[model samples]
Target chain A: MSVQPGPATALSMSSATPAIEAVELSKRYGEVQALDGLSIAVAPGTVFGLLGPNGAGKSTAVKILTTLARPDSGSATVAGIDVLRRPDAVRRAIGVVTQRSGVDPVATGRENLQLIGRIHGMRGGEIKARTAELLDRFELTEHADRPARTYSGGMQRKLDVAMGLIHRPQVLFLDEPTTGLDPEARSQMWQEISRLTGAEGLSILLTTHYLEEADQLAAELAIVDRGRIVAAGTPEQLKAGLRGDAIVVELADEVATAKAATALRAVPGAREITADGHTARARVDAGASALPAVLAGLEQAGVLVASATVARPSLDDVYLRHAGRAFAAAHEQEVA
Target chain B: MTTMVSHSGYLTVRAVRALVRQPVFLIITLMQPIIWLLLFGQLFSKVVEIPGFESTGSYLDYLTPGVVVMTALFSSGWSGMGFILDMERGVMDRLLSSPVRRGAMISGPLAYQAVTTVIQSVVIFVVGWLAGARFPGGLVGIVVTIVAAILLASALASFSNALALLLRSQESVIGVAQLLVLPLVFLSSAVMDIRVAPEWIQTVSTYNPVDWAATASRIVLSADPDWYEVLWRLGGLLAVAVVVGWLATRAFRTYQRAA
Candidate 1:
């Protein structure tokens, strides 16, 4: 009979505002359909991830939204400004740390930050203070005076993130921020990115292929595939929506996929079974209890099994369920 | 307007800082002008004795302005390299995404080369003086030489940056610019006296922008201070620089879509 009112006040203050929104955004690069009917809405002051494999139009969407490239069709708005109509205003309201490190390698980290600050029309004293604050926060204060090329990959990436914040933009886009970093560096970047979530009216639109990264950082996210949003929701909601355990079967050969799915479906409480390219996945009520029955049904159908696994539902399983293929395989296909 | 000016200032400062960080670049930049002044200056010392060649007190004075222009040519040839580096490093995309004036980005690298060319021209002039070169117009001639070098460097720098933005590849830009500059240098009076050069070469030199700079500076330093010729040639170099600089700014559109 009652509802939470305190948090709703904060949201209601600007209920009409979506920090970034795209509607049926489509782009074709020569023959490649980089983005097709891609759409998303990001809440203000939250980290929103565009989670997808490489070449899934994640970067394309970002390029359009950032005004670096134009979509063949469709429209978008960033920070309440229409990207297509007033790109310069959108540019001023956002900061971007692209997949590639954007720090000027030849200039000192301080110089790189100062350049962006000046570009944003910050006064000299303001740029100096902001640059100093960012360097200290990013742990680059010790090496702030050195050419960014001399810094390690992690350091340079941190500098890039800092550079993006030089103007205190309303929105920040980190496109695959941890792509080229080592594990240690990736986690460090993750920590740095995590610190910026949910504060100061600053919203973030992070594009990443790492499942865990999206899970850890974004409060809500969209799974893009073939330039379309396959699924979009809170991480937990998306995973929870795929109710039941994921039973993965590793097959010896690409054979009898339809037969295997039929057999798994015959088992009680098994649903949404699929056999694709030496792998069969099924959903069951209880992984431990349903495993033996599913296996027996497959064996009855004379389907040879290399191995099988029963695990809790995950984004990977959700992606598999929706896309009818593994995410890694689709990514590989794009790369090839 | 203030944002544009400040952004331009910041970008120029950033470019200069990059050059300062690389001490070897400064040394290598000087090497071209020094070599022309010392080796080429001495090797061609007897050119003054040619029947039509005016008797400049020494060959160094005759070669000083040419070497200065050549140095500007060589340095400006790689002006596009800075844009290539920024693109490769993703810095240009970062700037493009910001509110910075796009023209400021184009002019930053060009201004760095222009400043370096002027400063190096002074060094080349001092070296020429020590090596027995005589300046007929004294300080005015040195100022004219620096101004000429600045214009030449600015024009070449704009052309190189335009190529960088248009081609978006470092290797192609280097190959094209180097090829283009060689012909321009050979056709001009940078090395040989125009009178001693073939008649076609002499005629071509008159129309060459590089020759405009060389002639403007050479006249200022020669005993015959032909104000009209110097002013017109200097005006020509400035006009070319402005046109090429405007083209360089327009090239940013290609870059924006390129990403």
Candidate 2:
């Protein structure tokens, strides 16, 4: 309940005050530790992504930071306002687009926008103008008068985000904003989100399970696992943190995967060989130079390889290196 | 305080607008009370002829106020469905995370319910008049009857909201509301006269808020309205409304913690 600034503020303020800061947040629900000592800082006018698979506490962190829920232990600040002590102030300073669509399905798109604007204490003319502008911006102007339920899923999501931005908050929280969106809609949303920090001069904290989403939109990213951040850096830095390039070989069948892993390990610069199903993956100092040797080794070992490829380190590799498991595997485990 | 009032006003409009968009629901809800007034009024017209079943006019006159009060009970009992829908659709979280006043969330819907009760009561009164029910207490009596219904609806709506916030499930809210409404309706003079009912039923109705509303409405619409009885019951309904509304607003904290 204390309102005093936490260490995250002190540390980040020394450089430039973060638009959002959370220090050692921990939350427990019965036997599940939803969030454990999670800390993050987003610089002003930049997109910071919390990247994690499902149940990695990404949404939990967003909830605590946005003042929808409180962390059992820890403090947070949004727009220099204490989240725990003065949640209303934080609420005024930030706009939150939760993972779920928050649009009132029975209300028209424009009505939803106006209602939210009024809740934020916007004036009549201001609410009207802002609502129109947002509807146009989100390509929802044509459907502004229709009940939100009539809108497509992507359109409803767009209206939800538009309602969040109606008040022009200093910081925006997009918690898995593109979740459940079609590929085209997701890319469009990414374009809009990318433009927000620059065009609107708003800092954003987005959480997503998609590695490509984090890589495409975040200025800085954190990999969350089991309620804690396992890695935090720029997306490029996270990928570069892996020792070398990744060389993956898809075996013809599960029976050849083990042999392929052993064969790939014999290559001079390759290391960390692991086999999964019908695929074998290894790291090499250089992918282009190591590719021929890898394929040759597989051929010499009589391991029938269906395909072989070498590529620069991706966010997937970074996640695997740190989380000690494949990202897709972790995601599926959480889903199941 | 001003912000809370304004926020409540805006949200009330939102709720009303949402309801208006679904005209089918509105018609369906109105149909229930009209059907009850017509069917029950005809079916029980002879009950008034029994000994000790005192009445100054036809049976329809006695049943009109009862029907109004019953409509309030039945409609307000379902008010929680709106809250449950908001919760499921994530609209509750959106409002909670905004700078909106927490109290406004409860007050807004309560206000909407009040508005609905007025409309429904007026419609029932008009339908009763068309069906041969006449009010001797006239305009003042009609206004008072509507006010009583509003008060009762507000109280029940607050209770419904509290249940919604606590249960956070549509099926359970519907189940609990259905379970409570029938006993409240039949146990009172809403349909049957308390004079002819069992002594235990009469005693139970005395403490029931539903009975207070129906009895008060019936009294005001009578040839001789009792000022003391009308005011006392209205005051009691007001107190219950305030208490239940406060509890509903406080239930937001529990929802927040769980969220």
Candidate 3:
């Protein structure tokens, strides 16, 4: 088989460059600001995560970079093609698996793959061979002739990924690939996504509302909040950068949270103490050493130490530090 | 091969397959026209004897052309329902992200409407012939009848698709489609003569693309065929098809901007 020059061929020569880049991208929808000067650079051959809670603009960034939507005042490039000026060129080098299942419910799995391949300009033989391979790889061979709506959630998600890979794109964009799946299906999808980069040399940009998804799948991740990247680093780096463990204290009395905060202030090892109605939390360099001091201080001040625990810093702490609030709290605020 | 041809071929096949897979739906939808062919042909069979009803000897001859156009309108006007389904299912987003020819994306559904109309025309004409309606123009007349059906249906198909994207809601598209088709059909000569219609409706229907189709098909099916008038009406429907289809393609821009 002769491989003629195609738009995706240019992606190989651009291996030295970042696979995806978005600079100062902004988009506004009526009263909601979907993206505000958001930007990120993804290295070639790595899984990059744009992690955020619902309504945090993660999907907005994906839409812009994938050439499905345009930015108001910013620019993006995928596989070295300007997304706005040469969107068709960018499309040739990239594949997108949107948050929702895109497979035609009326069409069978095999027909879905064949249809997408034909649109990509693949020959009939190439389409048939690739469809067979994907159906097998995704373990969809048995149900290849069945309409996609009949498949299990995991099966459907697997077919969605296979559809995106029909053209062997250089970069793949998966927008919340495992959003609605159950735990088993979610883990299965995670495993399938992790294997895409092994032999294909494909760069991936993933967006998700689940923190564990980013930690488990992305090599590098950016935590997005309110249309901005609040913090970015490898999951380990972001967690380690917090410089210690977190000490959380829950009081028996909701009104005594302020008292509990004051009681825990004397511990020299503790810092950044804050409290809500029934809980108070602090950062300490060493949990084992700091636990006794924390308890003792509360006792001396006549504050009940209802319960205390110290755990290593997590991405939750990383986001709390950068955003000045707990990650879940911020997410709840947006949802509410 | 150009992307438009090859890409549209696959997409059109998908549409047709969807129809074939749901045989009951296809049957039910096509049966509506046949019901009209029998009910209207028999109920109003004597209307040809009424003054100012310029039908051939048999009212079925006049009603046959109307039935052909009605099948096209009813089927094609809901063409956007497919797009609404695609949007709801995220299939439209998938196609937009691919390098499918932009034209192919729009033409695929339009072509499906054309193909189905041809089948429907054949069915309607076969039934019309059983009711004693003779085609004075023979093969050319039958071809012209099918062409008129396709042209009118494709025009409504484009507008329906445009409304589907612009509204992005099945309920709203259905509402607007009903609003569009009822009046256009009533205003046109598809069901009745100008003398039977109110003066205002008759005047308004002169501009109705549906009437343009009905006029051309009625002429070509008549014993005294006016070839020039047929060209004029068919040309009008074709222009409307191109314009509305273009508008539907433009609606994609609106959808993408919001997506």
Candidate 4:
């Protein structure tokens, strides 16, 4: 089921043209279909997250939107410029920080910024001032003169984002921005990204596999699975769409999983049950009231429950409800 | 049009600055040309004494132009490494996604090779002169020789860039470059006079761009410079450079499509 944006987003959606829009975009790479009739619309001045597992066509979508690759069919636009017909114009309007760090390692951070600034047609004086401002803003001023290769991974990632923002682009694309970062750096990047949308009024299209990242930063998000949007809405809406809390029971062994699944099914108000290895998960209307019945049912079935807990639905639960599988399992399957 | 030119210029500066930052890499690249000028100049010194062999004075004098052309050829053949580096580092995709003219990606490195060829040719000239080789054609001759070298290097660099864009692998680019360079150097009159070369090699050398460059440079550096021979070969090299540069620029589309 396609969930519509909440009233807040709906009001904005009706008032302003979308900052980024793609309709039924599909792309094929020989035998593999990277994108299949995927579509999305991002409101201006908001962070739109494409949340997915690895190999979910997020990068491919970014590539096409940023004009780095052509889609086999469908149409997209960034800042109202058609991506296919006027890619250069689209390029002029959007900033893209790809999954890979795009900073030139041989050049100093300052040099890298200046070069990109020049490519974006910024004048010498403008480039110098902007470069300084970005370097200072990203906390890279101390190391601005050093070759980017010399910087730490977090620092290099910051430079990449700084480079993307050199031209004051209307929209920014951050593809897996914090994928390789440590916990500290990831949070730091999150703060920086949050500030970007608020003060600058820049629309951001961020692709992330991190559920927390999407929940924390995205004003609106679309969960992509197998090259299609499985669920799309505000994080709260997607979670609320499930209509209850999630009950997770940890069993003693893999052998008990089947018994636990059958047991959990008998408990009233529990539905959408899935069991794998030593864990059995289900959705219930009210976790506090439903937990004792669930555990009692499992006990009657002679299923040994190591522990059980119930919590409000997270993006993980929303993903399970929509995608019909766990996010981690999908990621593992992709890696395998 | 102006944007294209300016982008190309900025990218060229980027390419050159990258090389300049790594002085060790720059010196190592020049080592080959310097070795050929010194060692090969001595090794082939007696070749001019052979029957039907021609020389302005010594073998080193004849070999100086050969060294300049060979340096240009060998160095330019590896220009693809830079493109491959950019591709691997994700810089190429970043630049492609920017409002960058695709032509600049090709021309920038080609221009860098041209600048490198000039520096390399001058270095070889000085080394040859220090090792007792005399160029009677003087400063004008050296300038013309450097121009020929630049043309040859541009053509090779463009071809290398095209191969890099198409192959997108270091081993493949290296394999193809090695496959092309040695034959091109030996098949041309880089170290020996064509008069002493086999009939088929002379025929092959007549069509080789390397031969055009080497022969043109040698003629200009001789006591009696052949303006006609120099101009036509330089013109031929220019045409080849333009055609190959265009192909290299088009290769960006192939890369983008595949990407």
Candidate 5:
């Protein structure tokens, strides 16, 4: 089989550049500002993950970039076409796997592919051949003739991705692709996505609330909050750029939190002290070395220490520093 | 050598194939017209002496054409319910996300409804024939009547689907559809002739495309074929179909814009 040319091929030969770019894009739905002057650029042949809690406008951003929805203000270009002005061209250049899977449950898996291919103006033979290939790619060759409703959740999500890839678009937008899948299914989907991106060298923009999925799949990610981007960087950089490993010191009494924060600030290599309930967390250069001093400082201040643990800085830590709350805690609040 | 066959009729063929897949639905589509024929045919048969009524041999003959047209209207009016299902199920969104032309998306479902209308029309005609409504015009007349019913029904379905797009709510679309259909059927000469009806009713029927469709179909099916009447009624229905279809196009544009 012939390999699909990626961004590198075009870049190496000429001046073709970023596949998708949003310059301070904004969109509002009545009273709710879904996206607030968000800006990001995705290089050709790269996976750019939009990571945020639910209702953080990650899906909104994807919708604008894929040309399904337009931004109220600001400009977006996808695959060299203005999203709002030339949506038809943008539609031609990109494939979208929406948060809601769009596969027809009544139609057979193969029929679904053929139907999509035909709509894309593929000839009968071409659509048939491509349908066979997509079925094989998603490992649905056996179930190709069966109605899609009969497939497992993982199988359906896989087919969703395969459908997007059928036309070999320059850019692909996957909005929460593995959202409802079990861990095993999610992992399988991750592998498939990785293999396809690598093989075809396609630029992908994926929005996922799963932090680790962002870390594992995206070379770079933008952490979004409310209706704007809070931070943007590689997963390693975002984690490494934090002051230190998070050391959580739960005080014996809730009142010690404020006192402990004051006391911990004086300790060497500690930064960004925040107290919540009975727990006082501080970022330090080395949690192991700083723990004894932290304990000593708290003792001097007559603060009772109940528990203490030191660990490597994670995306959760970065999120906490940026958003003023733990990632999981913020996610729960959003869900509530 | 897999030479492609660009079936000019492929769109309609695919539409029929899709409609047939839903067997329960197909049966329901066929039954609505049959029910109207049986119920209204018997009721209006005895009440035909209300003066000014053209003496038809039986009420069934007068009602058959109207029932066929009403069935088409009823079937067409609910075409958008499928669209709502498509929307909720993500199938419609998937199609939009593809490189498919906007017209084709509208055509697929509309074509399917048209084909279903034809099948239902055929079933109604056969039942009417078995009930002693002799076809004086033979095969040509039957074919013309069926074609008129399909076109008129498909056109109405297109407009309804467009309204469905505008409303974007299944309950609202279905409610509005139900409210509009019964009135349109009643106001037209579907159950009784204009001559026997009150003056106000005759004036209102002039504006009802369902009346136009029924009149056209009845003209062709009746023993005395008034070519002028048939042509004029068919033309009026065609015009309504064009206008309603245009509204649907505007609805499509509105839907895409909002999305």
Candidate 6:
């Protein structure tokens, strides 16, 4: 958890040439630009999170990389194969669990897996064995013959991920794998995903809106806003990129926040500041070191600081640093 | 491609197995055709029995082919319902996202529908036989008729599935298909003689591929096999199948693009 500034072996994530790569990708649906010059590189053996809100081109990027949709002007490669000219190869190399569950509800869990395996060109014996193995791995063996419609949300998500991994593709694309699940189920899925990447060494690219989901699961991350990747790095790096800890000052009024922010800017190592409504936030290299200076300065400026706290930066802070708004605010707008 | 077809064959078997799991589907599959045969057969019997019909045989014999075609039409037209079911259940998208050939994924549902269509056609044919309907062209003709019905129905189902993709709503798709199916059946030479109909009806029948299928099916059932007439009707139905199948493929592409 101790992520240092840079070149700290405290973080094991190695940024490499990316198993999945997009170059100048752009997609337009009539007047709407679904993706605008979006580019990303996913390392070969790490969990890369495409962190964004809904309709921020997360799924669009997945489709392009998974060979489901062609980008209007960009190029992409998956597992070393060109997605445009050799999409079948890309399809062969990556497994995808879309935002929507792909498990056939009427069919048994085992049947769904077997059918998917067959579609991927596996014969009966192979499909049967793999289906059984996946069902067992997902802890659905007892219910393998039961209709998927009977599964709980967590069980269905597990089945979905198992179906994707049935063919053992090198890269896995999970688009919002836990969107509608309850908190407990979402946490279980996070554990399952962590186990997969850790045990199997599979490169996973997951798209998620949950900041904690990304923080808990992703080794590397990208913050996409308005169809562009505004920032990319490991969760720790992105968090650390904002430098040290964050000082959140809740003021009595919007004017107080403005006044408090202006005074706090004079403190050394207060790298950036953001003001929203009656709250102002400042990021500094050392959060503990900068707090007292900020408090004294705000007191001198006669700004009524209702409350203030200093804590380690989060991905939210990283998002705010890159996009100049709270991550939750952007999420709210995207949802709207 | 052979391997692909073999893989699709596996999918078809799985689809059939899934249907069998419900058990009621088996009954409805047979029950639907019988209802069509008896209801439409008796309803239009008096009108169809009028003299100077397409054949010298009883109107029941003449109505047999139309009922078979109707069964096939109904079977195929409802094929898109499977797409909706799969979509809602997340099956279709799952298959689509896999390395499976797109054609194979589509053919799974289509093949299941076709196999069941053949079963329904045979059941209808047997019921007709019990009612004194005979295949004048013998066993070859009966087998050919059944095969033709299956293929024709499968092609129709492909078109239905494409429509389903475009609409993506079950009520609208099922509603539009229901509205279109019986009208096309009634407008064609299915239950009545095409020649005795009004000039407009005759002209319309000429363009109704369902009419072509019905007429071809009739040629095999009634005595005096007019091989040339049979060839013409079969050719027209096949042409319709090919065109509609292509449209279904295009529709599938659009759906994939949207996805």
Which one wins on lDDT?
A: 4
lDDT (tens digit, per residue) of candidate 1 on A1-336: 786678678677555789999999999988999999999999988899998888999999999999999888999999899999999999999999998888888888898888788777787788899999999999999999887889988889999999999899989999999988999999988887777864456799999988889999999999999899999999999999998899999877677777788888899988887777788888887899988998899999988889999999888887877777787777778779
Off by over 4 Å in 6: A1-17, A249-271, A276-280, A284-308, B54-57, B85-90, B131-138, B257-259
Report the C-alpha lDDT of model 3 over A186-241, residue by residue, as the tens digit. Answer: 99888888888767778999998788898899999998888889888899999888
Off by over 4 Å in 2: A1-15, A252-268, A288-304
Query: Which run of 10 residues does model 1 chain B get worst, by summed lDDT?
Result: B250-259
Q: What's the best-to-worst order under DockQ?
A: 4, 2, 3, 1, 6, 5
Q: Which candidate is the best by TM-score?
A: 4
Worst 10 residues of 2 chain A by lDDT: A7-16
Which parts of model 1 are misplaced by more than 4 Å?
A1-11, A253-271, A297-303
- Candidate 2 lDDT for residue B42: 89
**Of 5 and 6, the candidate ranking higher by TM-score:** 5
lDDT of model 6, residue B20:
81
Candidate 4 per-residue C-alpha lDDT over B11-81 given as tens digits, one digit per residue, 9 for 90 to 100: 99988888899988789878988898888877778999999888859999999899898888888888898
| Residue A27 accuracy (lDDT) in model 5 | 88
Error of 1 at B170 (Å): 0.7
Sort all candidates by lDDT, best to worst.
4, 2, 3, 1, 6, 5
Can you write out model 5's per-residue Cα lDDT over B20-139, one digit (the tens) per residue? 676888888777777777776766677667767664557787777788888888878888887787788776677676656667666667667766777787898898878766667777
Query: 1 or 5, which is superior by TM-score?
Result: 1
Displacement of residue B108 (Cα, Å) in model 2 is: 0.4
Report model 6's TM-score to 2 decimal places. 0.88
lDDT by residue for model 5 (A240-288), tens: 8887688989889987778998998988888888887778889988889
How high is the TM-score of chain A in model 3?
A: 0.91
Off by over 4 Å in 3: A1-15, A251-267, A276-279, A296-306
